[model samples]
Target: MNLKATIFGLLVFFISGQFALAQSTEIEKEITELSKKKWQWMADKNADSLAVLFHDKAKFVHMGGTWGKDREVDIIRSGGIHYKNADVHEVMVEVLNENTVILWNRITLLAVVGSNEVTNPFMVTEVYVKEDGNWKLADLTFSKLMTRD
Candidate 1:
């Protein structure tokens, strides 16, 4: 009886672990696709799409300053900083849990700020959370890369 019980417990555990792994993979793929869409939206200055993706309390950290969702949206809408393009060099997504994920990417951005075009390499970190069965951007931070691309 004892041997049978142990075997049953081990089987349950193995099945649970496999299910979790599969779920994580699905989440990673979802977030990766979202991240790519987000970059394209930024380049296109689609504030409406971004407004939907970003949480109300989302925070954005940039080389110049940090701000909340409203401010970031306003900046994009007003063309304060225009994202012309983002040349992504590499990207990675990590599932922190069932409802949270983090994405890291190395990218070179071509942007226009105050009539000046600038291209800079950066390592961007983005955090996302699932809310109401949808993934929303929670936080974004950009670290300027010293190495030129």
Candidate 2:
């Protein structure tokens, strides 16, 4: 009876570990897709779609300053800073848990600001939370890369 119980416990542990691994993989895939869509929306100046994706308390940090959701949305809407394109070099997503995910990406961004066009490499960090069965962007930070691309 002791042997049978120990074997059963080991089997359960192995199965649970596999389940967790599979869950994380799925979540990573979902977050990656969302991140791509976000870049597309920015390039297209689709503030309406972005508004839906960004959480009410979402924060955006840039080299110049940091702001909350409303300001970010307004900036995108008005084209104060246009995201013309993003040449993504690499992206990695980590599932913190069932409800949270973080993504980091390195990209060269083509942007226009105040009539000046610029291309810069940046490391972008994004945090997403699952709320009401949908993923919402909670935080976004951009760190300028010192290395010239």
Candidate 3:
């Protein structure tokens, strides 16, 4: 009787652990897809698409602190940070929960200003949350690695 009970308990525990792992993996994959969609929107310079990805009260810290959506729009419109070319690499995502995610990645930026080509490397951290059945970026932070010196 003792042996049978122990075997059944162990089997139940193993199955429960596997179920939890599968759920976590699914959440991770969903968050990763959301991050990819955001990057693609940026690359395409689709302001509307990018806007939808961000929560209305989203905060973006360019290289400093807290830039609002209006400021972001102005920067985009005035060509303050135009991307002639760019690439994202080495992206890693950490899931906080089913609705929250944190991601870090390295991005290379290339911009053209009337024949002058500028290339820069940046490290970025982004946070996203599932709100009202859609994923939206809650915060974005960046460090200008190549421009430090």
Candidate 4:
């Protein structure tokens, strides 16, 4: 499909509530729940919980910069960028392989950065890998959106 058509399709998918009501597979439900909890963890600044969820070499990408797991944990712990809230409007889960999955969340985030409180729409991509029977976040990247509700 062309880029415009793809975007439109996604836009329609998000706007419709049918997907939310549809029954998900067992693994899909698991990952969706985990993703929801991740947002709560960030809002609560529970770095300890996040530390356990993030992979040892996980990478975090933000508007300002990109960093690894340690820095992300420290940033949350120190309130460098307080993730006050993430209003998740829609989400898509795509299982890549036996051990990998990709989750896309359309969210409007309320955060505090250097004493400045800001809210922005973002397309957040989270990649998860199953290791030792647990899912670890391998990557988290936030892409600011030009469109806003």
User: Candidate 4 lDDT, tens digit per residue, 1-149?
Assistant: 89999999989988664554442355677888999999999999999999999999999999999999999999999999899999999999987765788999999999999899999999999999999999999999999999996
What C-alpha lDDT values do all the predictions have? Answer: 0.95, 0.95, 0.74, 0.92
Model 3 stretches with alpha carbons more than 4 Å out: 1-6, 77-79, 111-117, 146-149
> Cα RMSD to native, each candidate?
1.1, 0.9, 3.4, 10.8
Backbone clash tally for model 3?
Answer: 0
Q: Please, what are the lDDT tens digits per residue for candidate 1 over residues 79-110?
A: 99898998999999999898999999899999
**Greater-lDDT candidate between 2 and 3:** 2
Of 1 and 4, the candidate ranking higher by TM-score: 1
Output the lDDT of residue 125, model 1.
Answer: 97
* Residue 59 lDDT, candidate 2, scale 0-100: 98
* Candidate 2 lDDT by residue in tens digits, 1-149: 69999999999999999999999999999899999999999999999999999999999999889999999999999998899998999999989899999999999999987688999999999999999999999999999999956
Per-residue lDDT of model 3, residues 42-98, tens digit only:
655667777777787888886435787766655554556665555777688887877
- Leading candidate by TM-score: 2
**Models ranked on TM-score:** 2, 1, 4, 3
For residue 91, give model 3's deviation from the true position in Å: 1.1
Per model, how many backbone clashes are there?
0, 0, 0, 0
Model 3 lDDT-worst window of ten: 77-86
107: Cα error in model 4, Å: 0.4
What is the alpha-carbon lDDT of model 2 when measured against the actual structure? 0.95
